[model samples]
Target: MPEIRFRPKYISFDCYGTLIHFQMREAVEPFLIGRLSPDELDRFIAVFRTYRFDEILEYAPYDQVLESSYRRTCRRFGLDAEAAAIEAITTAVLNWGPHPDVPGPLAKMAEHFPLVILSNSDDRHLAASVPRLGAPFHAVFSAEQAGAYKPRLQAFEYMFNALDAAPEDFLHISSHQRYDIIPAYDLGIRNKVYLDRGYDPELPPYEYFSARTLADVNTALGI
Candidate 1:
């Protein structure tokens, strides 16, 4: 067991990338086939990612956010955005399962503390994703309920209000610095874990620990 700053009331998480196998690239790649040259594919996907981030800045259904972003990105490259393509992306999200390293460590932690998720997901999509995670969660919150997404203070505020717990009561984990940890830090959640999945850069000033996987987090928590 390694030293940790605090023992939390709940082990909270940003589900999609931290635990769930987020396969956005895999899901959207087929749609771009022949529409973009091989070199253009990466650039287009990057733009799509940016639009996705932008879409989540304000309140909207996750499906609508996806649709808006997808359409905008497609239009930027002169490709026709189809309704079926939007549906395909939203449907693909439900099929994502946990990362291979998640379940055992999560189960171990669940013995000592309740597990919670504050995901940028629709309620129905969250329902589909949670059961596939193999470990039980004490609570799962969605953007649909909160009217906001990760990195937005409103989302965290809604989650905090719903859990009836203050920022100090939980240890939040995420792979995304911008989308989860950074906002969490700004909101005064000091006990956080940077699940270093390489999706984002690590900023030490935030004062959170780093873990390669949930297993590392389990060890850090002295489980």
Candidate 2:
């Protein structure tokens, strides 16, 4: 848990899955229908997620990463990857809104600390999703601007450079430890909050406070 009186100069967030409802699974589900049984489908989705993370290890356009990962997963299952479906998935991603619990507490936090976003998606997708969070951001950084993604040091490095701030100066909030907390911790961001969306386990070694909603994060920050 965070220190009782702790407050950061800036509160940074991992946009997708943490704030915005990540609907990648929903977007990809239609394409996989009829191709595999229920059990196989679950395994396929898990592998597809791994492939997407692997594809982002090197800098590339987000759409290209999605396309290549989707193709790889389809081919592994002996199914064809449809070009049109990739476009459809990208469109679906751009249209995703915040999770149900986001707006109120996030808005409250915005009133106290300057809020920022460090997201994996590009500027265009963020342009659509950020507004739906019902709070104004101090700044927003995207993988496209950084030329890198989370779990990679370059992405967080870009944010630090852009803000002209050190990691200790900020409090980071994210749901996925693998994508956000782990990398942020490595970069020396000590004040962290893991909003438990259940994508990953709460890792105590990383030294982050765990909460199930933004409301809990708001309370932790004393906002």
Candidate 3:
């Protein structure tokens, strides 16, 4: 069990991969459709994922990141690089809904504390996804609004300024170490929860509270 400490004014989250199914690979898989061998397709998918993260680090718009990742991945795989392929992947991201466990615990948590989303998504994309979480968010801060993406201190700074809340005032929860926990820790956020969804390995030195699922998160909070 993870140790829980410090009740927060708000519980901030990373919506996409943390709460939502974020079916980027599932969306891209059909597009491959025998263009590449199974092993090659998997390798392409991995490359696309890496490129997406790398793209975000460059401070470009989210759509550009998605498009460039698709183009680059296709080029690497010797596949036909087309605009439609990128569009399909971007569309899939906007249309994704929360994971099965997300709505219940998120809604329950919202009843007790304010819930906020700090996602590396644009406003247009997040608009479709946030409602699917089945919870009333106190605020949804996006990368477009921040003029930067996550893992950047500026994004969190924008969130804190918008909410008029300090770093110590909220419990930040996310599944991505690069995007959420590492940066949150650097910003002096003491109440951090690592929702381990297997995207990254745990680094104990970050000193975050860990939960296997949203249910574990709720239990840790004594909800």
What would the TM-scores of all predictions be?
A: 0.96, 0.97, 0.95
Off by over 4 Å in 1: none
Every candidate's CA RMSD: 1.4, 1.1, 1.3
Ranked by TM-score from best down, the candidates are 2, 1, 3
| Clash numbers, per candidate | 0, 0, 0
CA displacement after TM-score superposition, residue 221 of candidate 3 (Å): 0.7
Output candidate 1 Cα RMSD. 1.4
What digit string (tens of lDDT, one per residue) describes model 2 on residues 1-223?
4544766889999999999998888998888888789898998899999999999999888888999999999888888888888899878988889999999999998999999999998999898889999999999999999999998999999999999999999889999999999988888999898889989976999988888889877777676
Model 3 misplaced regions, further than 4 Å = none
**What value does the lDDT take at residue 4 in candidate 2?**
42
lDDT of 3 by residue, 1-223 (tens): 5647678999999988899887887988888977888998889888998888888875777888899888888888888877677788778887788888899989999999999999999999888888899999999999999988889899999999999999999899999998999999999999899888888899889989888889898898899
1 or 2, which is superior by lDDT?
A: 2
Error of 1 at 3 (Å): 2.4
lDDT (CA) per prediction:
0.89, 0.90, 0.89
**What residue pairs are clashing in model 3?**
none
RMSD in Å for model 2: 1.1
